[model samples]
Target: MKTESQLNIIFVPYLSPGHLNPMIDTARLFARHGVSVTIITTPANASTFQKAIDTDMNCGYNIRTQLVPFPTAQLGLPDGAENLKDGTSPEMLGKISYGMSMLKDPIELLFHDLQPDCLVTDLLYPWTVESAAKLGIPRLYYFSSSYFASCARHFIHEHKPHERLVSDTQKFSIPGLPHDIEMTTLQLEQWVRTKDEITDFMNAAYESESRSYGSLYNSFHELERDYEHLYKSTKGIKCWSVGPASSWANKSNEEKANRGHKEELAQEPQWLNWLNSKQNESVLYVNFGSLTRLSHAQIVEIAHGLENSGHSFIWVVRKKDENENGDRFLQEFEQRIKESNKGCIIWNWAPQLQILEHPATGGIVTHCGWNSILESVCAGLPMVTWPMFAEQFYNEKLLVDVLKIGVSVGAKENKFWASEGVDAVVGREKVSKAVVELMGKEESSEMRMRVRKLGDASKKSIDEGGTSYNNLMHLLDELKSLKASKALEKTNLKI
Candidate 1:
C-alpha cells in the first residue's frame, strides 16, 4: 500500500445541517490524513459551513469551501433560507430541486477550475454524479445516513413501485432487509411517503445512488452486518460503514481556539450542574432534534408527560407560539413545571453532543432523526424514540425493532387531536411507563452496553487498517486507476 497521499477531493453535501455536519467532518478526516479538500455548497448555509470550518481546527484538519450562488428568492424562501431549520415544506423542497439544477453548472465550473482528483458527495445530489462522470473524476457517495436507510432507498428504487409505495396504512417487510422490520403507513417518514411529484424525483435520486462507484455510511459494519454483502453486491460498489463521526469532531473547543479558531462551545454549565444533582441514569435528556416543531398543545402534552412522569428532566423545546415566537411555549412549560415543582429544566436548545457524552446522561427522549439516533448510539445512550417524519420512522424501526436500542412513541389516532396539536397518542400512563422502563437500570444498562460496543467498533472502523479505512483506500485506488482511461476522459455524454 502506498503510504503518501496525492488526492484533492471536492466535498459536496445536501444543504442541511444534519447532512452538512457529517460531510464536513469526513472532509476534515480526509484533510487530517493529508488529502486536500474544497467543500462545495450554497451560500445559504454559510453559517453552519463557517462553524464547521472554524471547528475543524480542533480536529487537526482545515479545508476551504466554495459557496455556489443559488436562486433563493424564486423558491419563495427568505434571503437566509439555508439558516432556517430543515422542515417539510413544498416551497423549500422546490428551492432545493431548483437549486440542484443550478448546482449542475456551478459544479461543472468548479471541476474545471479545481481539477480535483475525485468528487466526494451526498448521494441525493444527482448533478454531482453526472458531473463526475462527464469530467471522468471518480465519485464516491458519502451517505450521511445509516446503512439501513441507504439499503432501503436502494431497495425502493430497484423494486417497481408497489401498493405500499402509495399506501400509508400498510405494514410489510422489505424483501431482503434484515429482521422482521414491520412498518406501517403511520410509521413511514416523509422520504417513504408519496407526496406530489416527490416520489418520481426520489426515484431518480435512488437510481443515481445505485450507479456510484462506492459508498461511505456514517455507521459501523457490525451494527448492520445483515446488509453488508447486499450493499456490496448490489452496485459492485465498495461500501464502508465508518461512523459515529462525532467522536472525531467532539474535541474540546479550547484546542480549536488555540489553532486560530474561536470556539462556539455550548452553554451547558447550567445543565451539567443539574445533572450533577441527579443519580446516574436518572435524568431523561429530552430533545426533538434540530428540525422538528411541535404545536402549542403538543408541547403542553409533552410537558404534562414529563410532569406526570415525576422525573427530573431537561426538555429542549422549540416553542411554537404565534403570540410570542415560541418563548411562550417554554414559559407555559416552565409554569407547569413550577406548579409541579419537579425540577425540570426547560431550554430552547442544549449542547446535544456534550450532553449525550456526559456521564450523568441516562437516556435520550428523541424525535428519532437519524443524526440524533446515531449521536445517541455513539454516546452509548438508549432512546425514547418519538419519530416525526422522513427517514426517521425507518430509523426508529432499525433502532427499536432490529437493534433493540430504543422504544417508539406510536402514532396519534384522532385527526382532530392531531390537528389540535397532540404530539402522541401515548397518554400519561404510557409516558410514565416508557420513562420508567427507559430509565430502569437493567434496560438502560443493556442498551448502553450494546451502543457502547457499537461506538467502539465505529471508532475502530475509521482508524487505520480497519475495514472502513481499507475501504476508503481501495476506493481511492480505484478512482486513481480510472484517471488515465481514455473512455472516461472524453467529455461526451455517455448516459
Candidate 2:
C-alpha cells in the first residue's frame, strides 16, 4: 500500500465561488490528512483561495496551486473576468464560459504531465473523466450540493414526470425518491425543460459521474440519511459522504472570515461590531449566493419587506451599475436604515462563514444554494428559503419538507438570474410574512431545535472517529489500492 505522502491528487474546481470555495476546503482537508495535493485553475480563480492554501503550506501541508493563463484576450473578456460572478452581461457570461472551454486542452495536458494518483474535479468538467482514464487513474467527481438534490434530479430525469405534466406550472411528484417531493416544471432548469446546448452539456456531466471512480458529497449521513441510501442503492455506485466540508476545514475565526474572495467592502471588524450590538438570534442574514441577480423591483420589494417585518437584518448587496432607477431609491433606503440602525447594507462581498457563526445572527434568507444551506445548518439557523435557479428548488424541498428546518418564502416560479423578470418576483407580503414566521413565531423555536441537532451532528460527523473522518480514510486507502493494481497491470504487460 502507498503511504498517504506518496498519494498525489489534483483538484479541478469550477471558477464560481460556490463550487470553488468548498472544493478548495476539501483539498486542504486531504492535505491535512497527509496527501500531496495540487489544484489547477486559471490565475484569476487561484487568487480567490491562494491565501488559504499558502497558510496550509506554511503549516507543513503538501498542497499548492498551479496557475493556468486565462484566455481573456481571446475571449475578449477583462483580465480578471474568469469567474461566474464576473459575468455582468449575457455577452460577458458567454465569453467566460468559452474561456473555461478553452482551458480543457491545457488542463488535460497537465493531467498527463503531472501523473497524479487520482483526479478530483468539479461536476462541470465532464471531459476530465476521459482524461483520468487515459492516465489510468481514478477520477472522483466532486458534487458540491447535497445527496437529496442529486437523488431528486435523478428520479426526475429517469421518470420524465415533468413530460407528463400538462403545463409548466403543474406539479409532479418525482418517482422513486425517499420522500414525497413535488415540483413544477418551472422549477427545473431551462435545459431540463428542453433539449439544447446546455442540456447536452449537463447530460454529459451527469453521465460522467456514473463513469467516474465514484462521487463525493459535501453532506453528512445524519442530514440526509434516507436520500444518501436511495442515491447509492439506485445508482449502484461507490460514494462517500464527508462533509460540512467548510466547517471541517476552516476551524479558526480568521479562516472563516477570509474563506472565499479576497476583497471585502468593509473590514471584518465592521460587520462583527454590528452583529455584536444585536441580541442573540435577533438579526436576519440575507444573501442570495454569488450568482443570483435581483431586478430593481425585486430589490425594492425586499427592502420594503425587511423594513415592514420589524426585524434587524444585514443584507449583502452585490455591486452593480447604479444607472437603474432603483439605485437612488436604494440609496435613500440605505440612508434611512443606517440612521435607524435597523438594517446594515454591505456592498459586494461579506465574510459569510464568520457572519453565520456569530451568535447574534439568528436566521437566514437564503437562495437555497447547497453551500449556503449547509453553512446555515452548521450555524443551527433555520432558513427563509427563496430559491432562484439551478438545483436550488430541489434543495429547498429538502430544507422545508424533508428536514423541516426551514420556512419557504412562497416562491413559486424558478428563473435564472439573467432571465429573472416581473413574472418571477415574490411580492413584499410573502417575504415579510415568511420572515416574521421564521424569526418570531412559536414554531420557529422547534425548527431551531431540530436544526441545532443537525448542526451538532455535522460537527460530530467530521471529528475523529466520525463518519466523515472514517470515510476520508477509507477513500484514501481505496485510491492507493487502485493505484497499486494499475502498477501491477503494467508490470505484467512488460513480462
Best by TM-score: 2
TM-score against native, each model: 0.84, 0.97
- Report lDDT per candidate: 0.66, 0.89
Clashes of each: 3, 0
Itemize residue pairs with steric clashes in candidate 1. 168-185, 190-390, 319-326
lDDT tens digits, residue span 1-495, model 1:
122235678988777666777787677767766666788877756555466575565555647778888766766666766533633454665566666666677778988898877888886776678788876667777777767766665665455233445565656666567566666555544444546566666667667766777677777677777766667776676666656565654466443222211245445565666777667667788987666655555665666777777676787765332236346666766777656545566454566776677677878888776778877877778888876666766677788888888866664321211344344445656666777778778756787788778877766776788766776667666655665454454545564
- Candidate 2 per-residue C-alpha lDDT over 1-495 given as tens digits, one digit per residue, 9 for 90 to 100: 235337899999998888998899999999999889999998888888888898999998989999889999888888789999998887899889888999998998898888899999999999998998898788999999989889888888888999987899998988998678888999898799978999999999999999998999999999999999998998788999989899999998778877887753355466678789899999999999888888887898899999999999999998683446778888999999989999998887888998898899999999999899999999999999999888999999999999999999978767677344777778899999999999995859999999999999999999999999999999999987887887788889999
Please list the residue runs of candidate 1 whose C-alpha ends up more than 4 Å from where it truly belongs after superposition.
Answer: 1-5, 51-62, 73-76, 83-93, 96-101, 156-170, 189-195, 253-263, 266-268, 320-329, 335-346, 412-426, 480-495
Cα misplacement distance, residue 459 of candidate 2 (Å): 0.3
Per-residue lDDT, model 2, residue 224, is 92
